[model samples]
Target: MGLKYIEPIKSIVLLLLVLLSITFTLSIWTYTPRLDPIEQSPTVDISIGQRKNVKEIIKPYKFMIKNDEFMRGTTEQLDIDQIVNEMATWKITQLLRNPVEMNKKQMNEFFRQQNQFTLYFQGDVPLSVYDEILEIEEVNIPQFSFDRLVVKWNPKDISFEVHFLNRASGIHYYGRVTPIDTMKSYRSLVVGSEAYKNYAEVLQPDGTYLAVSNESLTIQKLTYFQEELSPTRFRDALFNDPNAVRRSQVDATHEEFGDDHASMIVDTDLKMLNFVHPAAETSESIKPSELLIDVIDSINEHGGWTNTYRFSHINPSYRYVKFQLFTEGYPVHSNAKETTEIAQFYGDDRVFRYIRPYYMLDDPLSEEVELPSGVSVANALMNSDQLDFGTVEEISVGYMMRHDPEQRVYVMEPSWFYLVKGNKNWKQYTPEQDGGEQYGLE
Candidate 1:
């Protein structure tokens, strides 16, 4: 009985040891492959919400003088004392460094360019004298007419006035001179020697004088002109109208498809569509009749081009069909020729009106897509059933579908295509490298 029990115990121990070994191997195999730390780490996710605050990082708005009022206000508000100090400092510095000299011509040219001079005359100076005065080396007469001269001068940094008047004694006399400084504070005054001497005094009837001096002048405070926004008459008209029709008309004027009858035709095929009748007047507003004619012309031109050297056949399986058209003239290459391809048309009768032949390949022997007279490519596509071509696909305008590597269907107005056939031999049809001759055989 003891031997039997010992044998059973030994077998049990062996079974336990086997199970333990298998468990250890399985645990090691399960965790043997380790992941790369960089690959396994979560990446930083940048969201659109985080970009909202980024706009605020743009530079601050800078203000500058943009109109006469702002300019006048800025000049009036300038600090006279500071300007005077700066002028004095500049003069002193220049004198210390061996005074720079300018010739009479140079001085005159500078004064004329700077617009810094005043004319002074006693009464009615002769035209000869006036001309002579203008001939003075540093004098420039006013471009506009004036009885009196009050000019801002550069060298002396002052405003001076010269008045010419007829005396009570029935004789002409000239002698009214006033310094701008006496009437107003000049932040800075610039005057040339000729201008300083010309308007230095004013003669009075009572033998008295009104002298302009530094004591009468004070620094003028600078002020900013605020810009006021006001509505124009046109804007008022729009706002006042209860119907709002005027506003719509104004808005329509700025649209590409606005009522403007003047259309820009960029057909490479030179298919002049009757967008505008010969007698129709092109104006700010485009008439619906003109647009209709244009659409028709576009379709006819495209059909004629595609049929010139190609023939397309209808596939029996595809019943209702649609045609997507593209035109040439992109990149404005003069030598480029127009080409079109049927990107996609459905065989299902549910979406199309009639099954028409859409050229899958550009073969010289293939039948061309037939088009009705005066029907635009857009209208033809939209009213496919009306044209008796096929059922129309209800795709929205501007929609596009890429069917193959070389074919794409675009949902646009039917008249948009001026040519409708893919040039499979586009490379051969491309203009010569020398740019001397056109690619296609005329």
Candidate 2:
């Protein structure tokens, strides 16, 4: 028995030796690339006369505050709106091809260039023609707008309000002058200032929190159910009767004032899906990249850009995303309400239920708004009685539905939204136009 025990021990030692040999072999086989020796280049000494030619860097513009702004200049008030609009349109084009860093592109549709351009100008200032401007090393497109254009004298600062131009109304942007050094490559800008970033955060008593148009959105409106649309289509789908049930279904129940987020779209079951917030945490969180891929595919299969749809809110937390059809970059607000909670899904995480509004050929911008300054809007929020002084986190500028009773559809208008901490419902602050002139507009 003792001899057998010694033999077993000897076998164990042999196994250990084998393992050690394998490890040594692997260590030898493992390739570690050695860096090549740095060849020392001989340094050529030169006097001042023999130095390399240095091109004079002429800074076209300098940042000086005549009115607490980055740069201000006078354009002879010659169609500033048109110039600004063109610039904005160009920016929109650029956005399609190149989205800003961290911003999600819902569709993978390559936006083809229709027209070629050599150079464009704002006014007397020959702005720099740059392919990109970035926070780090990528072009940021969300920091621009042409919705509200203003040309002012005295201080001689031209105001070009920068809002993200998608179907959905984007954040109310701040204004600043173009950087002087960047003037050569800078286009007409009032929004994305190098000195000051457009504040997207909710205004607290202490200060403002930075926010984006759509961030941490757990819900997304992937392709919607496009059955056919008619005026009585909703009526026929909802009830056999058009009197009480249809009336309640068609019109907003809670809203006695402006347009409510409520809109009734006929689902595939031929039932009306009233615009209601999707239930929380329906499914576990899924990858947004995978979700976006299906969205783009569906949009393409649906006759491709048949209707220019843009992301309304791509909240991917509860793994939900929503997109609205945009007509000429104006978001169709009520087209697809957040009824994905009960709507039918394509398979596991794809949504197919959304309201299909009648697309018009002449679908232009619903309204041109003169947004109040971030400070003024904050003041209004502080003055509001309905909203509690809770820990407000984010503030975004985007389009909300306004009842267009005449056209029997919801029209999108720019509005300020405040996301109170831990609350999903955005406290909206819209400027009440009492026929009196609102300050901060030209």
Candidate 3:
């Protein structure tokens, strides 16, 4: 009886061990290792999609809006905050992952909407110098229209800006495009004719190119300036110490403006010329804006002031303010920043000196010269030893003086300058290019 009972308990214990072994084996075989979250790069969706039909209702809308006649525009942009807020309230999103129904957990603010991005993709159709924008093929995007596309090419920096809009959907898409060299634009746009270049090579008395005739002859129906850039009157007005020399003079030489006055004198002497006073500060400091305001005040006396005339540089001593001049509404190029036009000088919280354009063409001439395009000039400069640019600050066409070796008469030729931002790496081609050196010299 003892043996029988012992055998039965052994069998039962053995069976339990086998079952436990199987259970443990199964657990090991069926187990899986957790994987890391799938990684993906951040991307922005820039699709211009149409709203889904309202309960499948059909409503016809214009497929295209026409504004192709306008070449450039300054379209007022909708505030970014306002656009975002509107998108949020409408539960509208432009993300590609958007599904008919999404788990609430997927709604993360970190995700970007599927709306158009500031930068277009590489494969997108790009604007060309010769592109007849009106004829360009339209894209098949929802709620998107080719209408109201604003293309701006700035030859100064060789920069392009494109703004694509959908007025109906209120989508604003824009970006600064990388400029490309177009052969037609390059070949056809040179400012200097072959004759002009050849003439420029002729030696002048001052060792400069004889680009224009020194005789001061007819130019584009306008007469070249015969008189020099000189101050109109000289007067003494001393303060703080009578022993200190103080003198003021006015120049009204701008050939174009006829009798509009320009002045040159010490900063304090600005008062003598009836110029607006510089603001007083407790610490004897004058802000650039203050000087700028003083310049604006002179518009009545110096009539050529325009929105294009910008404050370019201020002297290290905080004494002088240089205002850049513009030609045909475009900024004159810098080549190297210098006094293309001297605006004002500051000393002891007063405008001590002033110089402005008192001489220019009397009026626009009908003779159209095929002036070199900004892009063409920039390209030539890039290849030439003259200027290795960082970014061209501005470009303008103006007369650069040439004189006869014998008569010493002044001649003017329309020249172009590319005002490049200054840096140590830049090679100085001429002394006139140095705006910094000008502070001490001019």
Candidate 4:
């Protein structure tokens, strides 16, 4: 009897275990992971006809009447009937999921899925008028489509300025303004030249009518408008001739080198004379006196003779004559080459005379030489007091001899020296003129 009872209990327990196993299997087939309260639930598969109603889907969430502030607002005091009527008028039906509730990963997936339904509105629009409509208290959304979301609102508040751009073939359509009635329903139609036969209708706010086609037009039209405008001085100058001179007339006095003047003078007495030699090549044999004579002769021929002075015994015993050589008649060449050519021509014939000594005249002598108004010459030698008589007496004599190779005529320059007079004080005399008269020994 004990064995019979134990067998029946064992059979009953085995049967219960079998029933439990079947229940577990059925639960496994139907089970879905529970989502965190903050996390979006996983999407469940459903046939097209069995999709959840839009109202039922949004019923749990609070409907926000979009105020100026996005997330915060006063609780809508309207009754259900009033709310439904307002929503219907605005054509609003569905609520978009709040972006704040989504985590990074879920938000990314949602965006990926929702990007297909999002609408993009892009164009040039004035900001002032659009701000008024965007301040509305509430708006409604209506039926939705899977491929794209269609929303409608009254766009009465939108304002626009239209512009046209000429193209090679057809016209383009461009809308400029924010839609006050509908946010996502309105979109900027990017009409290309290939798609439209004429884009002229899109150019202005109220001009012409545009035609739409399905030919897959790829034409792109661009219109540029400047808000703040200014005129450039260069452009104004280029377009208009405001009495501007084509060639300016410079004053004769303002011209450079036009009134330049210079003169030659003997360095010994700082007197204005026609002749002056370069003190650099001076020698005892080529005395300052003789150099003075030669320079004076060259200046006379050059036509710039302003004044001349004779040397007198009253002024120190040295017999020196002074004169000014004017640059008024001096030859002016166009360039260095021309000047050099002229110099070479005079140099070959021993006619070129150095004008250094003349330019070295002191202030008193320079003043003596008459010059044109507003013209002056520098006295370089007056500042350098050292007389440049040659070092070697023989070289000086040789240079004087070579001064006129063609003529073969040699002349000794005049000089002054003291001679002892019968054991008394020395007296000076000109070697050429006085010979030895004033000198007692001679």
Candidate 5:
């Protein structure tokens, strides 16, 4: 309470303030905040099966060459691959749509030129996506889709020109091959393909020409053993959270898997799966190039390339796509059920629906049955009372899948397949059923 005590009191107060300041500074330097952890998407990384490259799924099923000397073609995988590999080496540029009107007659003339060859794919392949398969130089590739790539050149011409044709939409794209020397190699490959069969250029109602065999030839019928695949693999791969999913057996033949957002149905008897994801559905239209790429990636994510399935069809308007089962270089169609196709319907950027078979074809039986030639088959189809020739878009040799209940095996009988315009169904044409005579070119 005196002057002597005042100095000591002030000193004590200053020391306490300094200690408080030091405490505040230390607390500010090492402060730890309490915040919630970041959440991750459940389906970010899902793998239930083997993945596949884009080239494996998107490949040509037929290759045809027409020149002044011969008209021949082949469905052999090896032959097709050889030509595709050669084309892949060439740099293609100036991919633009040919605005010139080309009718069926003009197109046929183009095909029957001095030297030309065509590679036919099963679906409308966007040129941008096909950049993965072909060596394309143009970075600003336009939005164009093609089912056929026709390479044509004349003996006098220095360069070979490529035409991408969409048979369904009647759209044609033109591109050029650089370094004219590529033509010599391409021509040689075409010349050396002796196994290619003789074909007749038959014009169809759709302004497309089907190269049917002109002579009588035989095709072997294949019978394969059957193996069923597990549906659980798809469930685990598709569902956002497999652990939170519920399974329900509708009957002996039908089973279902679902969560709060999506559901998948399994047709056990038919060995098919149908997956639907409503939450991923969107009404916005997606580019064909983007759609095709996304669907392939989605299937590859779950190793969905179970069998030798090739891209068969695509409808960008409906956002529907299909991959058909192929055997011995021929597409296989099921008469009993839609068991030979892997189909997808897109909703926005995601898959809205996926329908595919769950069976894998084993090795074929040794005994082979013979099939009539494409000419005879075409004749039979032309004479069929049930089928109108006008509706026939194209004709080819394909295997008709028939299941033998007693033996528990599936038989792939090589037969003539005719594509209908309205439905695009590849109906199996039997000679006896059609009441048409088999007559090859004399």
Candidate 6:
């Protein structure tokens, strides 16, 4: 009986040892320790400049007020802002394409009518985009744009009428101003036109109008302290995957950065940057309104408005847009071609090409120089042999940006510019270029 019991106990103990060994082996293969969380690459938002609103970036640079007696125009910032603010309060309705066919003569007559205020923009601003600042009634708004807005007070109807005019394409839109009270503000501006300087509305040979001061006008020449921005900030802000970008020194004054899909070249001498994203290229044409809005949003997303820039030009056919730096209510043009403006070409709903100065204006120098009058400017333009008077579209005052390397500043010399048809380029007029009388005050 003792020998039988011993054999059974030994077999049971052996089976238990085999099961424990198998369990330990499985644990070695499948066990996981309590490890720490894996670290990730930190995402930091980089902003090299300030963001701006549509109203701030897209403002009227010039305006004209016409009454029964005479017409007055000004490029003063305050005056333009006042009118813009006043117009923003009113409700606009009944916007439609003007059905009446009018030739240049009839159009000029309508524009010169009494109790009229016209706001002129540098570029063809989309009516829908401007509706952000303007109070437009919700309706089937036409897809059109305007370079000027003509607001007229109808004393008979006791209301106001707004006309949107695209000087380039002759597309006209008319809207009725509402609340009935907005006319008072419009009237006040028109009635007070006498206090403002007188402007002579000269009809261009091309059937457009150019407003010039009757007498010699004076403007200020400004100087600004400029600061170069860091390339790393732009690389981080503009690139979708900044960490993957590789930087290489192209030369002493040029640096290039790129990844798999995009490239950016920094010209240290010019303090300008040109970025291209080939993947975003699209052959399809984008609507002017959408293109303009997208350009603003893209810059705002990265806070890329480095200086006081205003909407200067846009060619929808090529999906190209430009924002030029402005100072003291006047546009600024650089001696360096395409350097003083933030230019963009859109594709595939993304930024295809971006070229802009990587420098910001720090402060204005105390010294102020007086500029030549609009009268003299107009005279010079008309008398210039280099200019085709018939092809001349418009003339305006602007500043020529001359960079000073040693002092590290920009001297903004006030000058006159004449826009020509066909190419639509604003050519600068100087005593040397135009072979005209000296424009600067002695």
Query: Which run of 10 residues does model 6 get worst, by summed lDDT?
Result: 433-442
Q: To one decimal, what is the Cα RMSD in angstroms of model 4 from the true structure?
A: 50.9
**lDDT digits (tens) for residues 372-409 of candidate 1:** 22123323333333222222211111111112212222
Ranking by lDDT: 6, 5, 2, 3, 1, 4
| Global fold similarity of model 5 (TM-score) | 0.86
Tens-digit lDDT track for model 4 on 332-397? 111111110101001221332332211111122111222211000011111223311111010000
Alpha-carbon local distance difference test for all models:
0.24, 0.33, 0.32, 0.22, 0.77, 0.80
Task: Supply the TM-score for candidate 2.
Answer: 0.36
TM-score of each: 0.15, 0.36, 0.32, 0.13, 0.86, 0.86
Q: Ten residues in a row with the worst lDDT in model 1? A: 57-66
* Candidate 4 lDDT for residue 251: 48
Q: Which candidate wins on TM-score? A: 5
Candidate 5 per-residue C-alpha lDDT over 341-376 given as tens digits, one digit per residue, 9 for 90 to 100:
889998866789999888877778745667667777
Candidate with the greatest lDDT versus the true structure: 6
Give Cα distance to truth, residue 45, candidate 1, Å: 52
Candidate 3 structure, TM-score to reference = 0.32
lDDT of 3 by residue, 239-300 (tens): 22223333333344111111122222322211112222233212345444344445334332
* Model 5 misplaced stretches (Cα beyond 4 Å): 2-46, 179-184, 203-208, 215-220, 436-442
Off by over 4 Å in 2: 1-286, 304-307, 314-319, 325-361, 364-371, 396-398, 403-414, 431-442
Model 2 lowest lDDT segment of ten:
53-62
Model 4 clash tally, residue pairs? 23
Provide the global lDDT of candidate 1 against the true structure: 0.24
